[model samples]
Target chain A: MTRPDRAAIIGIGYSDISRNSGTGPGTLIARAARAAILDSGVAKEDIDGVVGVYGSDSPTVWPGYVVDSLGLPNVTWWDTAQPPSIVGLSSAAQAVLAGNCEYAVFYHGKYRWGSTSIASKGDPLRESPAHEMDPTFSNPLVSHAGSLNWAARVMRHHMDRHGSTREDFGKIAINNRTHALTNPRALFRTPIKMGDYLAAPMIDEPMSLLDMDAPVDGAMAVVVTSLERALDGPHTPVVIEAFGSGLPIGSEGNLWPEADGLAARRAVASLFGRTDYSPTDMDLAYPYDGFTILTMLWLEALFTEEGGGPELLRDAWSEDEQVLKLFGRMPMCTSGGNLSEGRATQGFGSVLEAVQQLRGTAGDRQIGGSLNTAVITNGMAATNRSTILSVS
Target chain B: MAHTRRNYDTQPYWEGCDQRELRIARCADCHTWIHFPRGVCPNCWSDDVRHEAVAGDGQVVTFSRPRVPDGAPPMVTALVALDAADGVRVLGRLEGAEPDAIRVGMPVSLDWHEEDGQLVPQFVPSGGAPA
Candidate 1:
């Protein structure tokens, strides 16, 4: 990896977004980029790479075009992927490693609400996985049973094996929203109790609304540069110690009845192999929760620490009787993940949260300790994309 | 389960249902074979590749029989790593997949259907049949 000392996130930026980009894409992208440039503490002239991806019906406004309109320097590279913010990050990493550019800018802003509805119309079966379980395939076409339902099935099996429940699952959302109370950006600021979660509307038989992440119209951007370049920027820089991505191979034979290990484990191993850091090394948890059960499944997949779901719930949510009994540690979703807080136009908000925590700029939602290690699992499909970031 | 019209992308493979034959792609670059789809090999990462028909004589690297059926007529599927190529693998419907008969490294050959314009791929025990 002779890629110029690689890259580290030096600054982060996000736009004030909501259900409707009442303001539209132009306004949202501008705001998100401005936040990124200012946060990076480096001049706007420094960003040479802008990568992004979007799935929408509106007119295509490529990231490079957005970069040009911003009156910033010429972009050496630009790319996009579906809703997974980390996909953009992955592309950015390749661009950095391939020596395509030095300072990079990644952002996405879209009307996430309408995207789902429009998406469902196309090859309805193609997008149906998000809404219902395809019993025809014996796999979920959509819903908790949808998409990566196999991962949840794995979690359910583990829970029964380890003695856990929907209530234990509630600890994750409960603790996340508790953190959201202080985040003005959070759309669902209404502090929730575990009971409140258990009572929420059910999406799948066992997964409830609280378990699934709510969608919002927001865009976030992150600035990355060489380690030497980072120190010269606004704040002390945190490097991306490792980022690993796994392509969906569907090796389980049956997506319905999963046996032994989950497919993403193969991918998780790839990332850990790169940096050799485990879950215990990270002080804060940023498990991707496109759906609630995924958070539980991810905790077990990380294997950076011991214990699975109940233990994870207990570690992050101490006040709850269910979690306390399991003996878990490491705070989860302190900025109120995509669930309690609102999901943004682009998925980059998760990575942006790590920057906030690392820079101690997380405002009222500030996590207690100076976050040294942060693990972010960012993809949503059966495919798992994850990265472990640390203060070097 | 609804006889949901299967997506045409895989009709070639499923069409091989009645007569057993397994379909795969052979690349022009390294004279190696592969499956799924590719103008190139994922292993060699080359675009200089061609699709050549071959007899699906492969060994079962690993397989799982679904107790209950899933997709098409509830049958077992196996990941076949072919002997013809290095590191080339494909998933195919298994025929005569008796619990006792199936074993890792079991020798199998292609038997398939050429339906609706596709060289659909399927598998049967080696020497039992060939397409």
Candidate 2:
């Protein structure tokens, strides 16, 4: 691969988050794009590229719709990536680095609580494994097992293989809720103790209600520009130091039953191998927490120096605040994560929060000291992408 | 029809379920088993893939009984790793035992259950057919 020109996120913006946006998807997309463009202090005409995440409910060609709505000049480069906002972000960065475009804006918009539930009303299942697992399928056991059930099966296997308990999972939920208390944007600001986590209604056995991420209607956007241009921009530029995306060793034939935290280790190796920094260098890290088990899996995968296991997770949640905030130790999910902060646009929520921390704009939830670098994992399973970012 | 949305690749798999036989794609080149019914062999990337019948006996890798509303009784839902098809796990209902009695690695044989006007693949204790 040719060495691409360096790129950095110059600005990040988000719409008012809530259970219901009470607006159309197009409105949300336009609102977020405008906010990001304004925040970057870059002219709208300069945004030559517009990339977005395309889910079933989203338009087949999102950039065309967004550009028209925002009244921006015809972008030289534009495309929509399916799911896993990482693909969209990577596309935008590639356009910028290749000089196809100067300023690029990547936005994710979803209406989970709108009048029409997007999951039920979106495009029909088309050639995806997730479709075969639907309840109407001839497989009764998995018919009922949606993503939650699959994650539960993985969690059970993790317990059987590595001696992780339900309480160990509970500790992760508790820690996320604890962190959410300071985040006003968080949906579940009310404190949840170990009792609450254990006693909460079970969605899938081994995965209680608390372990799942609450879906909300919201949008988030990030502006990517050349590193040289970012230096002249408004906020601290979170430079993309290194990135890698791929499937893990065990994710091949089946998804959940045989799945393990090692699914992304290969990608993790490539990510850390390319960068000068190790996992120890990150002052903050955001592991994809679509499910709490996912967060634990990412923590174990990237932080192998500290030994990747559930025991480490249990200790991290149990440790004192000073130790939690220490450089080399547990610096994960500081924005309360998906579990508490509301699952805002899938992977973009975590990336948005990491950028905030690196820019010293995280407000009440900011980590102390000179925060230089952060690591973030976007997507899951075969579509995973891990990125390292820093303020240089 | 139990499933009205199946495409060409998946329709036959569901049809095999109706016949009370467990069929999975096998690589004609390497004999590697593929679950979830795909076009090519994941192991070898071989295009010589054909759906073949197998002894549907497998061990329960993991099981769950989600507390949700449905017509069927609270049956043990398990991810079964087939004996004939190593590393190929399929999700099916575990029958002929209490939900709480099921354990990981326990032997289970292929079976079928009818619900929502569809015949679905299920598993029962290997000792005998599901009663």
**Could you give candidate 1's per-residue lDDT for residues A138-190 as a string of tens digits?**
22111111123233344444454557687777877777677777766667778
In terms of lDDT, which candidate is strongest? 2
How would the docking of model 2 be graded?
A: incorrect
Tell me the spans in candidate 1 whose CA falls farther than 4 Å from its real position: A1-163, A251-261, A304-307, A320-329, A345-347, B1-8, B12-131
The candidate scoring highest on TM-score is: 2
Name the DockQ score for candidate 1.
0.04
TM-score for the first chain of model 2?
Answer: 0.64
- Residue-by-residue lDDT tens digits, candidate 2, B29-80: 9887755554434444454667887888899887766775767466556888
Q: TM-score per model for chain B alone?
A: 0.62, 0.85
Worst 10 residues of 1 chain B by lDDT: B1-10
For residues B1-131, could you state the per-residue lDDT of candidate 1 as single tens digits?
12322222223333333244444445466665543332324334344545444566898654544333235343445556677665555555567656456665789886653434433455678877333
| Position A300, candidate 1: lDDT | 65
lDDT of 2 at A57: 43
**TM-scores of the models, in the order given:** 0.51, 0.72
- Residue B86, model 2: lDDT of 73
